[model samples]
Target: MRSVRRTLRTLQGDLARDIALVLLADGIVGVSFGAITVSAGLPVWLPMLLSVLAFAGASQFLFVGIIAAGGNPVAAVLAGLLVNARHVPFGFAVGDVLGRGWRRWAGIHLMIDETVAFALAQREAERRRAAYWACGVGLFVCWNLGVVLGAVAGTVVSDTAALGLDAAFPAVLLALVLPSLRDKTTGAAALVGVAVALVATPVLPAGLPVLLALLALPIAFVLRGRLDEPAHVREEASCPSR
Candidate 1:
């Protein structure tokens, strides 16, 4: 159909470039995750499996770190789940773009940070759908492939952190959120989030601090609501009756 062709063209053009950048970032971070996981004595196939199944970069790192530290597997799973709790809200925010029926099943696997950010950046429904799928599937493939490559190379590259690969994941996230920082409310929320995370980092166990940072969200929303109410009341009071 003509609609399908137009969609495909848009995907191959604008979406492809954005997805390519995401792919490269994910690939590098995936490689770092793979190498670090292997260096911690995990089998190469383990990380490759995680890349396909688990697929969340932060949670995967936390899982691997906990295991490597001789922490309980149960604890690792709990921590990973806690860190990934943000996806619950993310699923709600982009539910429309997730498609219907069996397609929703596929979309669930793709519901990570990058895909969510890219989708939200779009103003139009169709473009948001396209961006989500393109970034999600592309990053998934690239991440897995990089995992395989890095797992193999782990034997040779014992010092993955020395190569500065540790910064890749946060860098990608920063890039995604930077645009939204231009807005005052978003910027304020970000500052609050950073402050909360930093303060909690020393007191809480690895992943818990990030989860704690999410407390800023409700606070920001409530504050914004209160600020809007007075202005709304003032505007109504200023209006003259006919």
Candidate 2:
């Protein structure tokens, strides 16, 4: 009881602003996703369900985009899985902080990009757990709420394209990717992903282009290793006698 109280207080004071910012952004994007999904001719309930279940923003957009374009469901699922492959490493990295048993299981469901990043940003174990739960639970609630509202709005409206909501999904996706471009490795990976997707789009099926984009992951890893060698050698040379 006391422990839970302390956690809440700490979250309120320290993480409130950060969580609020995420909620606001996520709410808007979630709304866009819902609106776009409905505009694509899917039932409102579909996006609402996806927001609760799949929860990852980029893959969700891809799934809807593919379906909207008359792509195969299998292809969309495969592409979505490919995009979410990063979560495997994310799980390994934060496995320790997730606690044991049921908590671990539940934590896996809550593990998204923002939650993982916020949790890992903390140095202390306690704070890391707190941040993870705070971001996860907060986002889950806000995102779902936004989805419901957007779906409702989408159902009521006609001609979402004229309203410019058609572009919202891609715009949000670009916003998500822009920050990562600050890192040379990520930027290179993104370029490779984009090139592969663009090239494949002309020849391959709709969702298959996204699958081809997965090639960027290994390319990024190899580039990172090669890029680090020079710095490693320089540091080795600069080291005092050891």
Candidate 3:
């Protein structure tokens, strides 16, 4: 416990504060999601089940949104899978922080965009692990608690859109990734992703453009590899002098 506490303390005040703020915002949104789901005339247990089992905010929202629109449940689930396909790459990127054995499985279950971003933003492994678990576990608890509250309240509570709180998560995410954009490789990748997403938005289905944007990552990796090549080796190859 001491070690865990010490590890957590290594998070600078700013990071800890950021995590706290994001958690608060997410809890509010969770309340909104639950209230909206139940108010749409679905069973109260539906949102509770999704919150506990799916634990995916956007995907869950999309699922409920589709169902409320009279879309088929199977289609809604398939759409949720399509939206969540990004997790494959997320798993690859953040796999190191997951450790091994059952701990790894638990980490996998807790993984999300916010937690992964926090883990990636940290340099040290210990800090990465600490950030991942802290954000993931805290978010799980806060979101479920909010869901329960909203479910019980049912029609009494309104969605957060009335308060314009719906934008908090995206704003926080943009802030989290901006620092990473300072790197040449990441910057190139991000620019390409934005362009791809913009271009594909009108043509492709909702989740597909995000997947298409991920193709930008290979450009970053290739650029990084070329950049990492030895200076002398490059000079020799270029000049090929007597």
CA shift of 206, model 3, Å? 2.2
Off-target runs (Cα >4 Å) in candidate 1 are: 1-7, 12-15, 156-165, 226-242
Error of 2 at 175 (Å): 14
Per-residue accuracy of model 2 over 1-242 as CA lDDT, tens digit each: 67557667767664667667777777777777788898788988889998899988778989888888999999889888877877887788888878888878878999888788777766678888888888888889988888788888874433446666557545634554476676788799989998999988887645567657778999889988988998788889889765
Better of 2 and 3 by TM-score: 3
TM-score for each of the candidates: 0.82, 0.67, 0.87
The collision pairs in model 3 are: none
- Measured by TM-score, how close is model 3 to the native structure? 0.87
Per-residue lDDT over 25-82 for candidate 1, one digit per residue giving the tens place of the 0 to 100 score: 6787777778889988988788988889998988898898999999999999998888
Please list all clashing residue pairs in model 1, or write none if there are none: none
lDDT of 2: 0.78
Q: lDDT tens string, model 3, 1-242? A: 77458658876687788888878888888888888898899999999999999898989999999999999999999989888888999999999988789888888989888998888888888888888888998899999988888887875447577767767777777877888998888899899998998899898767789899888989999988987767557888889565
- Residue 134, candidate 2: alpha-carbon lDDT: 80
Find the candidate with the highest TM-score and give its number.
3
Order of candidates by lDDT, top first? 3, 1, 2
